[model samples]
Target: MSKENKHITVFEHESLRTDRGEQRLTNGQLEALQLFYGENGVPYYSLIHHGVRFNEYVGVIQVGKTVIEVLPKADKSNDADRWRNVLINMLHAVGIFDIHAPSNSNLRLRSNSILDLYFELFIKEVEYLLHRGLVKKYRKTEGNRTALKGSIQFAKHISQNLVHQERFYVRHTTYDKEHDIHAILYKALKLLSYINTNVQLNSRLGALLLDFPELYDIKITEALFDKIALDRKTEPYRNALEIAKLILLNYHPDVNRGTNNVLALMFDMNVLWEQFVYVSLRRHKANATSIAAQNTKNFWKPLSGYRSKMKPDIVLNKDTEDCVVLDTKWKNLNGYNPSPEDLRQMFVYMKYYGAKKVALVYPGSENRNQSGQYYDHSSQDSKHLSNEECSVISIGVEKDVKAWQKIIHENISNWCQLQEIV
Candidate 1:
C-alpha cells in the first residue's frame, strides 16, 4: 500500500516516509498531535512542511493521510529484529506489564505488517498465560462413550444410538464456560485470529499455537474483558491482558470509529528511550547512592511561593549531597549538535536543582556502531553548568546487553564522580 494511502503500520522514531513530494501537517492536525504530545510528555514527531516548523526537532511530515491511517512516523522497517526487540525491552524495563518473551525463531523476519507482528507476539503471551494454567471449567457434554458431565437437557436428549452396548450414559447438558480466564483466553485467541487472518505466518508461531489445546469457542470483545473481575488466582493474565487489549482495540483498519478519531498503538522514541535509560541506570543504584526518575517530582521555587517546575529526566545522588541530573534525547547527537533549547533546559536544571553536573544522554549514531562493545562519545563544556561542567553523553544502541550495561555503568560512575567499586 502507498504510504500516502490508508494503512495501519508500526513505525519507528524519526521514520516518516512520503512519496507524494511536498507535505505538511494540516493546521488542525498539527495542533492535535502537539497537544497530545504535551499532555503525554512524549515528543511524538517532527514536522517540516513548506518551511513551517515546530516540535523538538525537524523532519518531513506528509499530508493527505488520515491521522488514524498515517498513524505516525516511519523510519525503520518492522522486518528487523532490532525494532521489535527494542519495543519489547523498553516496555519490559519501564514495568508496563512485565513480560519476558522468550527468543523464538525469526519472529522478526517472518512478520512485516504491524498487525501481524503484534498478533504474533501477543499470541505467545496469551499462550503463556493460558499455559501457565490451562483455564478449565466444567463444560457440558453429551456422548454415548462417557458418563453424564452436567445436569441433563431432557428436552433434546438423544439416547437412540448406543456405542459398543454402552457402559456410559448419553444425555444433553448445558454448562458454564464461566466467562472466567478460559473465556478470556478463548475470546483473545478469536481476536488474534481476526487481527490478520490473511497474512502469512512463519513456521515457528504456527507450530507454537498448536502446542496449546483450543480452550474455548466463544465471542468476545474489549468490553468482555472489562466486565470480568480478576483476583489473585488469575493475576498472571494481567500483563498479557494489557497488551492484548491494545492490540485488539487498535489493530484494525479503522483504529477508532469516527471523525478525526485516532487511537494510536504507537510509542514515541523519546519517551521509550528516556524510560529505558532510567530503568537501566536504576539497576546499578549503589548502597550509598540514590536515583530518582524525573527528579522526585520536585519543582523549583524561582520566585518564592510561585512554583516553577524543574523536572529533569533523571537525577542521581551520591550520599544525598552531590547530585547529577541527566536527561535523555532520542535524536542522534553525533550527527546533530545539541540545540540551544536543550542546553538552556539543562542549565536551568543544574542551577535550580543544585546539580553538580547535568548530562544530556542521547542515542549514538548508527555510523559509530562497534562490534562487541558500545561506542561511547561525549562533548564536555565548562560554560553549561553553574561552576562545574556538563557531559553530552551518547552511547551506541546496537550493542549486546552486557556491553550496554558495562558502558552505561562506566558513564554513570564517572559522571557522578563516585569512586569506582572494585
Candidate 2:
C-alpha cells in the first residue's frame, strides 16, 4: 500500500490488491477494515488473510484517508471506469441520487471515486440551500431572562432564583435556525471536511463550513428523521437533508481506538440489481396490464407456528391472469446453465402464483435467452410431459442506462407474447 494513491477501485468479490499481486491496503487500513466487519456491524466484506475481500455489496468505503470503491461486475469486462459509470447510472435509475446536478460531466470528470461524487453532490446541494437562504422554524427554548415573556417555571424560579427576584426562569418559543435539519447538514459538512480526500473540493467545503452556522449537536437517529415534517418552507432543504441522512447514518467513528473511523456507503448488489431491473421494466410497461414487484404469497405453514411467505421479484399480469413471474439474479451466466436451486425456485413460483410462464433473469455481455420446459415427474407415461415452461433471460448491459432498459423491456415483452403498446 502506498500513501500517494489514496483512491482505489475494485469490483465485488475482489481482493484488495492490484493486478501485479501487490497489496493495496496498509496494516492500519486492514485493521480498520477488520474492525468495521467485526461483530455488531453489517458484514459487507470478509477478512482475508492478506486483506479484506469485498462480497456482493458494492459502493464506497473510506477508512482513514484511503477510499475503497467496490463496484458490481456482471459482465466479463474488467474496465473499472465502465463499471463505475454503470454503478452511478444504476444508482440514478434507482433514485438514490438525483441526476439534476448542475454539471454531470464536470462531476464525473473530477470525481475520482464514488465517495468523491457523493461529497460533490452534498456540497452542491448545501451551496444551493445557502444561496437560497437557510430556513428557520419555531423551537422551544428555556433559559433565565431578566424580563418575563413566556410561561415561567415557578418551581425552578423559586428554588434556583430565590435570591435573584428580578430574573425569571421561563420556557419561551423562538423562531430560529437551531433545528434538526440544520444540525444534520452541519454534521454532514463537518464529516465531509474530515473524510474528504478530493483536493479540489476542500476549498468549497471550507467555504461551506465558514458560511454555515454551527448549531447545537444532537444525537442522530433514524427516528429523528422520521419525525421531520417538511412543508412548503422546508421543501427546498429536502435534497440536502436526504444526503445528510445518508452520510450521518453510514458513518461509524471508532470511539475506542480512535483510528478507524469507517464511513461505509455500501449497497447489496443483489437488491440493487433486482430494483434496477424492476424499475426498468416498470418504466416501459409495453402491453402488460400490470407489473408488481416482490409480490408475496403464503407458501407454507405449520400447524401452530407462523406461516412462511414466498416473494417473487417481478410478476407480470395480462388483464386478470398471471402471465410471467421473473426472478432477477445479479450474475453473469457465462455460458453456464442456471443452478438446480434456481430452476426449482422458479418452478415453485410458477406453481404458487399460477403463472403461465416463469423466467430467471440475469445480466451479461450479450443477450442469451434460453427457453426450457419442465418434465412431469408424476406422469406414468414417459411421453406425457407437462407443458410448464421456464426461460433463462440474460439482458445485455449497455453503456447507456436507457438503452439497457429498453432492451430489457423489449425482450421481456417479446418473450411474454405481448406487443408493445406504442
Candidate 3:
C-alpha cells in the first residue's frame, strides 16, 4: 500500500470510523483524535491501505503502522452534574488548567470544561485549611495555674481526673472558658496567608519550600538573590527566573505545592503519550488539510555519501504536486538557531525523498523566516542539489497546555505555507 492509502474518521457521537480511502491523515491528527476518543470511552478504529493490523480496546484506538493511539472525550463528562469533576481531572491530566478562579461556580464550570476536578478539589482543600486551625485545643479551669508547683500538680490531677471522670462530669467541670479562639483564628489566618503566597512561588520550579517557617523564609530570600543574578544576564533565562515568576505570580504556594506533588505522583507513560499525540494533532489541524507517510528502505541511497538512512517524520500530501517532508524534533529549537549542519541534513532529506520542501519542527517553536531563505549553492559534487532546491523550516511546540490544539493548528498551517504544501 502506498502512503496515500490510510484513512480514519471519527463522528461526533459515533463509536468509530475507519476507511481506506484516498484521503490520508497526518500522524499528529490521527494521534490526537485517538486520544480524545479513548479518554471518552468511545471505540477507536483505523484502517491502512496496506495490510497492517491494529489492536483495539474499549476506549483506545491504535494505528497499526504508526502505533498511534487516540482517546476521544478523555475529559468530557456524560453527566451534567459531574461535568466539573471530570473537566478538572482532564485539565490536570493535560497540565493546562490554570489555578486561579474567583468563585466556586467559576472553578466548577471551568474545571468541568477542561476536565480538571482535582484542581478544584485542591482549591477546596486550601479553603478548608484556611478556615480551620492547624492545632488542636484543650480547656483548663480558671484557677488551674494558681500555684507554680501546685498548679502543675493540680493540672496533672485534673488531667488524670479528666481521663477517668464520667463524660458529663468532665464536660461540666473541666472545660476552660478562657481558651482563645480568636488567637487561634488569627494564627490560622497567618498560616493560610503564607501558604497562599508561597505556593505561587513554587509552581514554576516544580518544588516547594518545607512548611517550616524559618526554612521557607530562608528559601525565599535565596530565590530573590538568584533572581537578581539572572536579571544581569544578557539573554533571558527561561527555566529558572522566569519560571519562578510564573509560580510566584500565578500559583498559591501552599496550594500549588500540594498540587505539584499530586501531579508528580500521577505522571505516567500514558499521560506523556497522550500529550505527544495532542501536540502533534494540534499542529496537523493548524497546518495541512491532509498528511500521509511512506516508508522507503534505502531511501537515502540518493544521498548515501552525504547522509545516512533516516526516517522522515511525515510525507505531507498537500494540494500542490510538490511533496513536503517533515521531521519532528522533541527538543527546544529556540535556544540555538539551526546551524549549517542542520540545514545540510534537511537538504539531504529533501533531495532523497524528492520533496521540494522540507520542515524541521522543534517541540515548541513556530516556523518563521527569522533568517532569510537559503539560496541554492552550486557544488561541484553532482549529487548535491543547490540550496534553492529545498526550503527548510523550523517550528516550536506550544507551551500553554490549553492552547496546544490551536497552536499546533496554526503551526501546521504556517509550515504548509513555508513548504508551499498547501
Candidate 4:
C-alpha cells in the first residue's frame, strides 16, 4: 500500500505541521488535548518496518468529514506504554471492551496491545455508579426553568432565526459608517445583558455553586443576574451558562497560575487523580475510603501517646478483613525510602486495624533499594517480618493505573486467600 494509505489517518481540530523539528507536549498539555478532544475518540497506531496499523483507538476529533488520530508524544520507546494507555482510555470511553471482567478469561488483552488487560477490572466501578444512581443523562430537562418558555431550547431557537438576524447585522449595517456608535453600544449592552441573565438562570451552575461553596465567585454571581435582566437574545444567555458550568466543574483553587510549587503540583495531581484514578477505582467496586490523620487519631491512641496524626492518602477495603493501606506522597523516594519512623507508624496501623497489607506509594522517579521488610520496635523482642509478611509494598504512583490496580488487587487477594487458608 502507499505510505499515505498504509498509515492510519488522525484528525485534529487545528493544524499540526511545524518547521521547527518535533513538538513535545508536557503531561498537562497532553491532558488538555485529551479533554478537549473527548477522551474516547483519539486513535493510536503503530509503525513497524514502514508498515503502519491502527494499534488502538485513543480519541477522535470529528470536524465535518474528518477524524483525527491522536497519541501522546512518543520521544522514546519507554513512552510507548504510557501513550498506549492514553489510547486504551480513549477506547474505553467510546464503549469498546468491558473494563471489568473476571481474571480467568480471554478478556485479558496483552498490555502491549494498546488494549488494557485490566479493562474488565474497571467495569465493577461503572456498575457501582449506575447502581448508586450517581450517573445521569447529560441533558435530561429542557429550558432554564419552566417559566423561561423557550430560553432553555436556545440553541435550537437560534437555528430557526439565523436568516432574520443575518439580514439585520450583515446587510442593513453600513460598511463604512463610523458614526453608528449608538448602534454598536446598544448591541454590546444587549449582549452583556443576555450573558448575565442566562448564567443566573442556569440551574446546573447554581446547583454546582451550592454544592461546592469554594467555587462561588461574587463577580460571576452578579454578572449572571445582570445578563438575565438585560439580554433579549437567547443565544448569548445560553452560551454564557454553558461557559459558567464548565468553569464551576473544572476550576481548581489551589493552582498558582505561574510557579510549579509543591502545593500547586499536589493540587493538580489530586485533581487529575480524582477525575481519572479515583473515579475509575470507585467504579470498579474498589472502596476508596478516606482516613485522614485526624480521622485516624482515635484508632491510634492505644498504641502511642504521640500526638502527631498522619493521614495516609487512601485506604482500599474489600471488607474489614481484606484491606490495603496506601499513602500517596508527591515526592520521589530518594534512596532514603521510608524512614524507621515511617515504618513504625505504618506498623502500628497494620497491627491496630488488622490491616493485612500496607503501601507507601510515591511518585515514580528515582529507584530506591527496598528490602521489603521493616522492624517493629513495639514488639517485645523487636520482631522483623518480610515486607510481604504483613504485606507492605512501596509502589511508584507514576506506573500505569492498570499496574497500580494489579498491585493493590494482588495484595488484597493474597490477604483474603490467606484468611481462607487459615
Once superposed on the true structure, which residue ranges of model 3 sit more than 4 Å away at CA? 1-289, 293-296, 300-308, 318-320, 339-341, 363-367, 371-378, 381-402, 418-422
How many angstroms is residue 127 displaced in model 2 relative to the true structure, after the best TM-score fit? 2.0
* Rank ordering of all candidates by lDDT, starting from the highest: 2, 1, 3, 4
Give the Cα-based TM-score of candidate 3 against the true structure.
Answer: 0.30
lDDT of 4: 0.35
Model 2, 1-422: lDDT tens digits are 35834777788988883223544777777777777777774658887686777889999998877788898998778898898888888988998877333563235335667788788888988887888788989999887999999999999988889899989999999998888889889988998998887889899999999999987787999999999999999987887788889889988887767766889988898899899989998888755367889998899899999999999998887324646899999988788889999999999988788888899999988887899888886787767657888899998888899998889888887777755422
Number of the candidate with higher TM-score, 1 or 3: 1
In lDDT terms, how accurate is model 1? 0.52
User: Best by lDDT, which number?
Assistant: 2
What would the TM-scores of all predictions be?
A: 0.58, 0.92, 0.30, 0.33
User: Over 4 Å off in model 2, which ranges?
Assistant: 1-5, 17-20, 99-109, 380-385, 420-422
lDDT value, residue 8 of candidate 1: 33
Top candidate, metric TM-score: 2
Cα shift from native, residue 113, model 3 (Å): 21
The residue ranges of model 4 lying beyond 4 angstroms of the native Cα positions read 1-218, 221-267, 270-310, 316-321, 330-336, 339-344, 362-371, 379-422
For model 1, residues 1-422, the per-residue Cα lDDT tens digits are: 44433433324332333322234334444454444445455443554442222333211122224433222222333444464444554554576534545555224435433344555566667656545655444445565444555454443343533333433444544444354556555555654543333235434345545665556564447677787666765566665667667654543332232223233455556776778778777776666667778754455566556665667788877224577788888765545557878876776676677776677887764323211111222335533423345667776654255456556666666655665320
